[model samples]
Target: MMENHKIAEEVIDAVGGRENIQSVAHCATRLRIMVNDKEKINQEHVEQINKVKGAFFNSGQYQIIFGTGTVNRIYEEIANLGLATMTASDQKKEAVKSGSKIQRAVRTFGDVFVPIIPVLVATGLFMGLRGLVMQDQVLALFGMKTDDVSKNFILFTQVLTDTAFIFLPALVAWSTFRVFGGTPIIGLILGLMLVSPSLPNVWSVAGGDVKPLHFFGFIPVVGYQASVLPAFIAGIIGAKLERAIRKRIPESLDLILTPFLTLLSMIILSLLVIGPAFHTVEKGILTAATTVLSLPFGIAGIILGGLNQVIVVTGVHHIFNMLEIQLLAQYHSNPYNAIVTCAGAAQGGATLAVALKTKSKKLKALSFPSALSAFLGITEPALFGVNLRYGKPFIMALIGGACGGFVASLLKLKATGMALTVIPGTLLYLNGQVLLYILVNLIAIAVAFVLTWMFGYSDKIKEEVEK
Candidate 1:
């Protein structure tokens, strides 16, 4: 506790003291501070603070990297020191009203989907496992026929995988509402309404098995399954509308009227306007992405592979969910997975290089787990915690990803599905392509390690950050 407080105090002082701070917040890896005067910040001093990995000014705020868990303790001490603690929702509300259009959109995408990543990760693992168990070759290798599989076991895996996509809108709406300052339960209920079983199943509509319901003889509405955009749009409107209604109603009547009125109004708007419009826009985006990703010579693969992690850093990588789903549905394979995996794997490579090159104990301690996490298919630990913080490692990783992606394109590599890469990616690719996947990942890691060691990573810089 004393150490945390001391670090917090130093960080506060280094960023121009508490008075220089307009507001303070922290995410999983960094202390995000909005200051009244950027000029008051002693940049070098802050970078020199013990346990401060790296610092940079971006998008009107200063972000000081402290890796995971540490930032929370430091942030708490800042709060104890009388600095106001802003909730994630409060930050979202502020960002929307004040930030640029693109910034607001990216923040919203992040806010809506980040709350649901855990379930998605679990589902990805389940998919990999299920695919492994269901393969005829694997079943035969186990001295069993595909027909001998246990129905109950298949059901269990299917349930885990199906639940997330089947009711995705609820998660999106609930998160969106929470971020947008509305009642989360209300938002979730509203999202549930968008995918209610009373409406025709989206697949049936798509396959021409059923027609979308015609509302008032004109508007066409269907169930939103495996969709993200509709609930996000509806959540914003519902949150804003609920807040507006709460302000005008009597305090005693607020509880009774607000939830009912908010759900009713949002449901009508979503079914008639937001759901249809956003769904159309989502389709257009998926179509365009498909065209680009299918280009000859793997140009799309190389570009996406090289720069995909850069997109992940912006918190808007959730936008690709629809594209991946479409690719798998249309082609039975997703090249996007192969490409993004390279980007994800390269971070581990770069971070490993940093760890190997760094002499500082603290730097080595932080770099190892960040690199390991990236190799296991999560890169934020390495990206924000190490590579992005150091600057050069991140760029080197991008180059490695591009090179790996170009190779994947040339090899015509694809994934059985989206999600899972690096270490975890091996399990899904074990269907006779394990050797190729291993080779590709090794190439990416080697490229990133070589480049970062040669030019990006420096032991001197690590010493300065820890000085």
Candidate 2:
């Protein structure tokens, strides 16, 4: 571990050191770095390192992809060096004064959410699997349902999955605080205020004619529970407040009083301004989505289906998960969920196709189980080992997914509940057009199989078999 840390430091220096970085962030398995000057960075040297899996440049960011479990530690090391700080010029990266509205919006969204992908995917999978087990009687029978097995098994799983989202503000607060070189505990306090039961409800606080109750007739914040932007704003405020308090208070009582006053002031401010502002933003986003869906479903299906794989590759697909869950909370069912179900099935079909088409005994053996796993919505093996290796499988999966998504949208199929296991969860989206979605997926796999057999097979197998 120590040696790895040293190597990470060296790699950072080789890439151009902390001073060269304008901003930095990490996703599931990649570090996204924006530099003051791209010409100064040595891309080839970074890619040649044994620890680095791949490197690419896209959208003006240099992305360094690492193998599983490696990028996180390197990210931490980079954070420790205070590399995330952006100057006035760096902030211009998303300037409304310069870029078009669409460009600015895209850059802003990517900057805010890309770093949070790993946590989202890990927790999403946990929640999805937990839902599947609890909802399925057969699976629950395998000691998962017994109270005697673990007194709080259900609660444990619920908290594990739900807490990250329920307390998302706090997570963001802590992450952003650390990025700014402030005490993380300050952010935690701000996060707690958002989700606290004691806080006034959104309707009561915002609607009532009361002058918006205050702590000291000064701090103008409201609540924080389950809030996102509020916590982020609070963290920023807390960092500055902490610095001020640290200077004023005596060195002896500094530790105790600084935190107390910082927490109190920041919490109040967050409730007053940040919480309400972001709440409005959230409402506006939902409203916009509803209006968009009211348009022709065929157009919506094509756009969503085509971009689905692209989103997944960039690790922003969790944004869709957030959208789905928020909609489910509001309306109890969402058509977008059906889109994901079909996408998973498409991946499974492609894997099956590759398995059937491959002539190499090793490749065939690898694909067989991977295809089965993909059917269950576990696509990592299929994606990393088969689809990505051969390339054709991924395209086939996308084509099939678009077909299934188009049919699903046309039929108005919606998921009744969420499930991680694709095959078992297909029932959630079942309707009059179930057969069409299935047929489309199978057709996609068949097409992929024929393509792979014709193009990907080795001459050695053909020659020997012919003889």
Candidate 3:
């Protein structure tokens, strides 16, 4: 307790003292603090502080990296010291408002989806494992035909792998509601109603097992499963509408009437209008993605693979998960993940080369872990902390990723899931193309490493060390 307070005091001092802070928040890995003035911050002193992994200013906040658990303790101490604390969602809203329209839209996409990533990660792993177990070779080894696996086992794996996506609307709606200031539980309930058993399952409608219900013998509506855009739109409407309704309703009836009216209106509007309309938009996005990916000679892959990390630097890459998940849900495969994995490997590769060639101990210390983290599908540390700081390395990594993505697309490589990549990403390719996956990774790493070593680390390396 005392140590946390001491660290908090040091951090506060480093950032030009408590008086300079306007608001503060913490997420899984960083202390996100908004200050009244950036000039007052002693950047060098903050970097030198103990228990600080790294620090950088982005989205109008000076975010100090603290790995994981330590951040919460330090944040608690700072709050106890009387600084106003913001929720993670509120912090995202603050950050999103600082950007240009396109950047703000991207950040908004990230804010809506970031909270749900853990569930997606778990679903991805489960899908990978299920694929591994169901392979023909695995079945043969067990002295069974494709049909021989126990029905019970298959059903159990479905529960693990499909539950999240099957009810994905609920999850997305719940998170979106929280981020947008609606009652999250109400958001969840509204989302559930969209996929209620009373409505035909979306898959059943698509597969011809059941028909979409018609209203007044004309318009048709159905349940939403593995759908994102609709759930997202519904959440925003539901949240804003609830707030507006509450403002006019009297206090005596507020508690009961507010929720009742909010859900009732949202339910009818979503089923009769929002779901069908947004579902079409989602399908168009899915089709476009598929068409572009299937373009001759992997041109789209090369271009996207190269630019994806660049997009990450702008904090917009989180939007790609939507594409990956949509592909997986509709097509039972995700070539996008395969291409992006190569891109991720290239980031690590370039960072590793910089680490190897750098003369500065500070650069080396920061680059190594950042490189490894990139390989494991987390790149902020590498992108923000090391690669972007050196212009050439980032460009070199981009070129390398293009080459890797080209190879992946040409080979028609696919992953069983989304989210996991590189080392842990191996689970995604366990359907017997392990060698192909490894080859793609190596190609990316090798290209990025050679390019970076040859030209990425600049003459400024020694100058940084001297400072």
Candidate 4:
């Protein structure tokens, strides 16, 4: 482990040190980095690192793909170096200053969350599958569900998926702390505080009315259960505090004292500042969503449908997940989530259209499964393989998705329960009018088909026009 840590440090230095990084996030096997300047990033040098599998860029981020088990350690080393700064280049700086309030909020969310998509998808899939298995009686009898499945399937997958959310903070804290260069142990403590059952609710007040909570009579912040932003902000602050304390503490006691001070300061700040601030931000997101969905159905559908593709491209789709799940838990049906489902259905149809129209055997073969997988709510395969490659299919999908989204919103289509997959998941919204949902899905697919057929698949266009 020590030797690996040394190599990780060297890799950071070779990639122009921490100063070059604006933000860092990882996917299934790739470290997605947004740098201060793309020119400053030495891609060749990054690829040369011993454990690095490869490096590439897409959607405005530089990605370093790593073999299994290597990225976590390297990410830790990068964070330890204190290079993750939020500052942007002159162009981005001006955009930040000049952009409208909504634009700024969207950009901020993107900056913080885009890099962490792989983790979200993996864990979501895990959770979804676990729900599927546990809900099945056959699997329930086994350890997979109840540790007694008569079937011979192994139950380990059940344990891993079912318990992911319970320990999710530890995962987020570890990742956020690695991004900020803090001790994982300290992050674990802060994460524990957010999820700890012993913590008192802020809503309780002396006169039987709700009131805000305070931390040690100093900072005022709210509880953070199943939250993302607060813990991240706290982790960064904690890392910085640890570094400052480390510089002043005596060498013999530095190890113990540094963490002690850092943890206390971070907890105070989190409760008082970070947590409440993010709560406000969360409210803002909710307000915006409510306002938009209140508009006429057609306009709402068009905007959401059109933007759904853009949202996924930028990797901010998970923000919708928080709203969908949380609001559904509260309200039993969410208009926003229903629109998102419509958008997914649109993508599925567009991809399927491209698959059918393409003349190239290779393209057709690849797109078919991609479309099917996307219909099942796994989009990356289709997004990267078919729609993106062909370009026009994606454009068609966006337009159709927006149209579908608007219609769904207009109709006030709401999901009664969460879905495990986007397509089959749309069934969650079915309320006796299963035919209406099916019709809506079919309409989106038909629009996508017409658009793709008119535009022509990339491969077919090249072949016919060139001929």
Candidate 5:
């Protein structure tokens, strides 16, 4: 308790004392402070503080990383110091007012997607596990052929692997409406309308197994299974429409009228305008992504893998979420996942090297845990806390990412999932590609570790944050 209090007091002083703090909050791993004056905060002094792992100014907040459990304790001490504490959501509402337009826009996408990641991760694992057991090699051990599997068991497996994706639009719309301040239930109903069983299945229509239902002799309609962008746009529009309608209706008529009008209007707009228009746009984006990944000689891998972490530094990495959804929707496989996993693994590698070489016990303490987090598919601790703090290690990691990307591309590796990387991400490759997945990650770690150890880091620069 004393240590936490001391750490909180030091943090308050480092960020120009409590008077400079307009508001403060803590997320899972960082202390987020919105301050009266950014210029007054000593970033280096904050990073150098005993329990502090790293500090950076981002999205209008001076964020100091302190790992997970420690942050909640530190936050309590900060509150005890008479500086008011805000909930994470309340802090975000205030912070949004100060962020640039681009940052705010990207942050919105992150807000919409963050809640949906766990569902996707679980579904991916289900798909991988099913594939593993269904594989000929694995089944051979049980003296079973593919045909020997019971039809009922196969149907049950499909239910686990396919349910989330089939109703993905509902999830997207529900979250978007919640974010945009409308009734989430309305958004969910609207999403269901898009994939109503009465309409032709999208994949079936695409494969020419059936024709789409025609409206007004021109527009075609089909179920929007496995779609993302159209549902996302529809959700935003629906939320806004519901809010607008609520204001115009009488208080007595409000509940019934608002939802009825919103749904009626949104269904028309989604089917006649948003769905058809944005799905085309979404396809174009998917095509571009596919083209890049298909580039000869693994050129695409080299470029995206090397610069991805740099993108992380700019704090716009969430943009990839949409592209990833589109890939999984269209192809049921996400090469982007494999590519980004390499980038994440490389960062872990660089951080590990720093931990082993740094004589500073403080630096060593910070680096080891940060590296472990990176290996577990969260790279912010390793990136902001260690590798980026030392300039050469980040660069070395980028090189390692590029090498791993090349290997992944050469093998044409794709995961059965998205939103996971490094260690936990092995679930996505459990089919028949587990060995290849391990191989690429190992190569990434080895390259980054070797390069960082040999030339990128030394004890001399242990206390300094790279400029």
Candidate 6:
């Protein structure tokens, strides 16, 4: 108790004391502090404090990483000190206030997309499993050919893999509306209208199996199955329109009239204007992404793999969520996942190397679990808690990531999913690509471990550890 209290007090002093802190919050692994003046805080002093692994300013908050179990105790001590505190969600809102327009926009994208990732991750796993079971070699071992599989069984697998994507617009719209402060149920209904069974299916229309319905002899209408940008934009516009309508309507009629007017106007606008216009824009973006992913000699993989962790430090990596979704929607696979996993794997390897080499028992204890966490596809702990704390390890990890990415691209590796990476990410590669996946990740880990072991730790790190 005495140690935790002392640590909390020192943190407060290092970050320029109670008056500088506008608000404070803690997540699972970091104490997030929003301050009145950034220049007043001493970052080096904060990092030197006991139990403080590292500190960085990102997305309008000064964050101090202190590993998992330790953070909660320190947070309790801080709360007991009678300083102003808020929930992590509220702190994120506060942090938004301090960010630039572009930063805020990127953060908003993260906010909207993060909630929907689990469903996609689950669906991707199902797809990979189904792909494995349905392979010709696997089926032959079971004494059955592809034709021997039941149509009913095939339909069941499709249900597992296809439901989320079939209703992707609804999911995106629902999430967007919630983020933008509008009624989520109304947004959900609006999304359903875009992909309504009454309209021709998007794939069928595209494949020429069916003609699009011609409205007014020029505009053709089709369902928006697995679409993204149109629904996202529509949600933003719909939410604002709903708010506007609510204000103009009388209090007595608010319940009945607000939703009716909002939906009616949004339906027309989305179908005619938002859907057609934004979808073209979405296609252009996807084409550009594909072009980059196909760049000669694995250039795209090398650049993204090396700089992805750097982007994470800046706190705007969530924009990749949109691209990953777009790739799955169009191509039924995400190449980005395989490439980015190298970045996470490299960070884990570097942290593990530190844990093995460090003389400080406290540092080793914190680093081992953090490294394990990174291998399981969560990099924040190992990253901010260990590698970045020592500086040189992070650079070594980046070089390792670039090497792994080059191999992934050279082998034309891709994943069945997004969101999950590194170890749990193996689920996405189970369809005959497991060996290749393991090889790529092993290379990443080995390169990072060797480089970090050789040059990342030095007398400077030892001095910091002693302090």
lDDT of 2 by residue, 81-116 (tens): 667733323543523233455555555444444455
Off by over 4 Å in 3: 1-18, 23-25, 42-54, 66-97, 100-104, 458-467
- The residue-level lDDT of candidate 6 at 410 comes to 81
Name the lDDT value of residue 269 in candidate 6. 89
- Judging by lDDT, tell me the better candidate of 3 and 6: 6
The whole-model lDDT of each prediction reads: 0.80, 0.61, 0.85, 0.62, 0.90, 0.89
The list of candidate 6 runs beyond 4 A from truth reads 136-143, 360-362, 460-467
TM-score of each: 0.81, 0.55, 0.88, 0.59, 0.97, 0.93
Report RMSD (Å) for each prediction in the order shown: 4.2, 9.8, 3.2, 10.8, 1.5, 2.3
Off by over 4 Å in 2: 1-185, 195-199, 203-226, 236-251, 316-325, 328-334, 378-380, 411-421, 424-467
Backbone clashes in model 2, listed as residue pairs? 194-224, 194-225, 195-224, 195-225, 220-272, 221-271, 221-272, 222-271, 222-272
Model 3, position 376, has a per-residue lDDT of: 82
lDDT of 2 at 13: 72
Order the candidate numbers by TM-score, best to worst. 5, 6, 3, 1, 4, 2
TM-score of structure candidate 1 = 0.81
Which consecutive 10 residues in model 5 have the weakest lDDT in total? 458-467
Comparing 2 and 5 by TM-score, which wins?
A: 5
Pairs that collide, model 5: none
What lDDT tens digits, residue by residue, belong to model 5 across residues 1-467? Answer: 89888899999999999889998899999999999999999988898788788889998889999988999999999998999889998888788777779999998889898888888888888889998999999999999999999999999998997888889899999999999999999999999988888889999999999999888988988889989989999999999999999989999999888999999999999998899998898888899999999998988778888888999999999889888877876787988888778999999999999999888788889999999989998888999998887889999999999999888888899999899899999999998999999999999899999999999999777645434
Per-residue CA lDDT of candidate 1, range 30-106, in tens? 78888878899998788667777667765556788777788898888999999977875565455455557777666
Q: Quick one: best lDDT, which candidate?
A: 5
Per-residue CA lDDT of model 6 for 1-467, tens digit only, reads 99999999999999999999988899888999998898999977886688887788888888888877898999999999998999999999878876789999999999998999999999999989998999999999999999999999999999998988989999999999999989999999999999999999999989999998877888777889999999999999999999999889999999999999999999888888898889889999999999998888989879988988998877889999999998988887998888899989999999999899887787787788888988998788788878876788999999888888888888888888889899999999988898998888889899999999998876468687546
How do the candidates rank by lDDT, highest first?
5, 6, 3, 1, 4, 2
Give lDDT tens digits, candidate 4, residues 274-294.
877875686677677677778
